[model samples]
Target: MTAVMAPSSSADDMPRPRLLERIGIPRALAWGFLGVLVFMVGDGVESGYLSPYLLEEGVSKERIALLFSVYGATASVAAWFSGALSDLWGPRRVMMLGLALWVVFQTVFLVFALPTVDFPLLLLGYGLRGFGYPLFAYGFLIWVTAVTPRRRLGSAVGWFWFAFTGGLPTLGSLLAGLAVPRAGAYATLWLALGLVVTGGAIALLLVREPTGRARLAPAGERPVATLLGSLAIIWRRPRVGTGALVRAINTTPQFGFLVFLPVFFTDTLGFALSEWLQLLSAMFATNIFFNLIFGVVGDRFGWQRTIAWFGGVGCAVTTLLLYYGTTAAGDNYALAMVLVSLFGATLAGYVPLSALLPSLAPDHKGQALSALNLGAGASTFLGPALVGLLLGPLGVRGVMWTFAVLYLASAVMTVFLRLPDSAATAAHPATDHPATGAPATDHPAA
Candidate 1:
């Protein structure tokens, strides 16, 4: 479908002011996305090997899991407020805060926790770091939403996730694979810490303060509502609420399934570590391509329809096939790799929901975007928690099937997504409200 770019300003209209106009939109967004990527890469460097390292250092498996759970929980709360804070303080200020916290907490972890392997310090340090990337990366996301035109929102959000996923767990894990063997885990961690600080500083310096039409709300009109109330208000919106659920389940496979995938591949299917890593690389490589492709597809087909058919249903089918290929097909690595890639590609459909949420609540883009991120943070904890709990009783096969069903359920939930009247009519004015052959009358002022 043809994308309608931002509304053009006529010569009679005042020219909208811009931040970093010298470099223009492309350069500004590139620097912003790169900043997010570097931070995520730093976060992800530990994804594949962190648990094992803890175990090697004499930390119990249960304690390691507990650390993740705590980090996720902390991140969920941080994710919610981060958006609202961005709206209040402006993205530039909020992002700087997040980056500062990242550096401080990471430094603590490297010094106190890494050397002694102290669990308490690790808990505090890592939990604080959890607040870092969400605020930093998602702060940029809010900046993007504010700046991007309504019609091209899908493309912008898609690219955001492209840089996001491209770094984390995918590229990060790849880096860790190399670094862990050569540099050792502590050194790799130090490297990641250095990168995060450097990336955050550079991105902040490059991005000018947003002004003009790019600003989300009036300078003095910040909402006075409680954070919980703000979140509740966004959740009450039909499209935004449904989008949240869709977002939560959309990443279940990544957080949940991937938790068990490597173990199953190496232990059950008898694949080598490098081979499983290769499979993961292939999946993310395909995901990077499809994320952009489906953004255009959503612009063409409608975002809701793309979510239902492509993301929800497609994830269900591919997940089931991938699981089956792993268990029933018995060591068919070739088939398994194809199914994994298909799963990754299908997931691209949900990327548009990021754009859709902000579009639904233009007036409160921060709250809507926060709701979107809350779903992501919730999935991080809940997906793995559920998998951990179910793995014992249901077995790996059973866990995969359950997540596939959840994907289907999330897709079905999309039926309830009704765009707000304003957004619905903006792009298609004729259908939502029509004029009658009566004299124009103004209602009494409310």
Candidate 2:
């Protein structure tokens, strides 16, 4: 019997050739990401400040956490479905909806901030924001990957993270800190609402309306409905299963360890709100620098190696230093701040995931990306809660170990997730790891 290979998407599938064939950067893609950054600034305003804002309005911690949990739950549902929706509706339309939601969701809070509305309304408001966010991010990533080169996707994703996580959050927190105090909560809310709307308009221009829902159907797969069935066919492969595990496990440090670092400072170390924001500021700054640096590292050393060297082992050591170094009350704060910077810089394996992830299905970039995003979005909640449970018994120290283990798990799973480098000379014996000195012909992503 003659063997048949799954059809692979060629350079022709990319939107950039006609759009920016001459320019090295995809101007539209850059704009799309920038618009996302702007949208996220408004988003961070809510995440970094909204809980505290609610607290100041006299909400209890238990209630706030319950609200947080509800938002997380809604986001989880959105994550599971949004990518599939983008697949059906096209990334541009899905993203536009996300942007529209951000504008309206916050406005809902602004209008409903009255004391009489009660916590359920507040929960509903937060849930809407949460639902909108990952979908927006999902759309943004799809747009970025479609315009970018397959070979350079890792570095492109690095830039995406630099803007997505580093720049936007930094600005968002700053705006929230500066605006909320001076203008009061409603004023800050109005300003963010305007930003989201303006950002969406820019995105609409930047994203270029999708030519069709998701990737143009495989030659004979005329409708997207047929592509949806292919998703099930692809998921049965070992590659998708292993790839999703690599992505989900690797994301824990960022979603799990990083979130709690702030909580650790506030709850265990006793830092005031101002001090916490300042520390977060430092971490975000460092995150931007590392994002650019390690992205290059992934390009040079190979993404899997970077994950093992930086995201994996680096996470363990950096986290432990935070756990063990500070015995006295205030002593923990300075060391924790330093360690948090390290986490921002080194916990960057997630950036390479965009490249590593899409390559998993080789022939199905859309489904692969969706699968990975689904895993990652789900991890946002799972990672935090998994560690949160451990925190009660393990205390700070025990949680550190859990974080370390999670990073280690992320690293080990790399054994199963490999991306074949198209740039590699086909003539070279396929026996070497491109980025690492070590031989990794045996590894999945090698």
Candidate 3:
């Protein structure tokens, strides 16, 4: 009798393409990201001057900060469950709910709160609006992880940040600059509301539900773990915890730095509004390229080292150079722009983290990714609060130097991050650790 041979499964059997091919990210998914970009640009139109608008409307600066604090806090808490809910109920249903809630809150803010300049109503409306974007955006992130192949996960995540960073506070600011001058903040916000509804609808239409992953049963049973219980994976894994920390560290400087950097450049430094805007554009453009570049690098070189050196140490050095270089360069605006652009480019090192965190928790990606967003949301509140407290006493240079130290601390933290044994085993089957079980090779985070 002839001996029967079983079919062999091997990495060689799987084709790995050039990172530039963008294989892991499907085309329709990219379009959905573009829809997200549209929604953000509208929402972000206020990024440049919301405080000034509020102050002009007679609200105290302290009150405005409190409003923002509430918004950030609410968003952070919402983010904690958005991913888990996506995992449990499916991304499509949760995202639709988020969009509907955003429309309702935004309309209320524009109609009732804006007309009367109602502080309490503003708090309620904006606070509810906070729940809108993270669910839509992070829910899509979970969708991305589910559909993309493991090999191209980093590149896909890079594109996610590309949409995220490129739209908000960058493109959004540019659009705001134009609109606030001609249309006024009130009308401009209406335009933003329209975009949120339209873009979210487009995303819903374009993106499809994932079929491959296991989901919580629709009717027969509750999940084995409660929503809170599901998050235990994060505490159990060192890599996941480090990822959350790194995400918080990566974003903290941006919020804190932006809080003062714009005014300092235009007012204190005596640069023209147009000149400062141009410099910002250049810096963010550099950031966009590096986001994609580092994603590819992470795939070839290794994600952890890429984040530790490029993200942690690179951010530390570049941040210092940006602050001190501007101070030392003085009247040399061109040189200052160069240093700032370099700072933005170095931030790309953290882009790979979207991919790395999910890889660390194959069995609990929804929970892991939610933790990542939780840290990000917390940073938005914490970073600015820290800068606000220190700004009076420390001054710009001193406060900025403190920001550099935070980056260094993040770098130090990265040393403890290690890929989960399951991921390692998937990569090299012969080296399987006894602790690892089923291989989780695809998932998402932001």
Q: Give each prediction's root-mean-square deviation over alpha carbons.
A: 6.2, 6.2, 6.3
Q: lDDT tens digits, residues 310-342, model 3? A: 988898899888877787766467897898789
Ranking of models by TM-score: 1, 3, 2
Residue pairs that clash (backbone atoms under 3 angstroms), model 1? 1-300
Best by lDDT, which number?
1
The global Cα lDDT (0 to 1) of model 3 is: 0.69
Residue pairs with colliding backbones in model 3 are 145-443
TM-score, candidate number 1: 0.85
Could you tell me how far off, in angstroms, the CA of residue 185 lies in candidate 1 after the best superposition?
2.3
Give, for candidate 3, the lowest lDDT window spanning 10 residues.
1-10
**Residue 276, model 1: Cα distance from true site in angstroms:** 2.5
Query: Which of 2 and 3 is the better model by lDDT?
Result: 3
Per-candidate clashes come to 1, 5, 1
Candidate 1, overall lDDT? 0.70
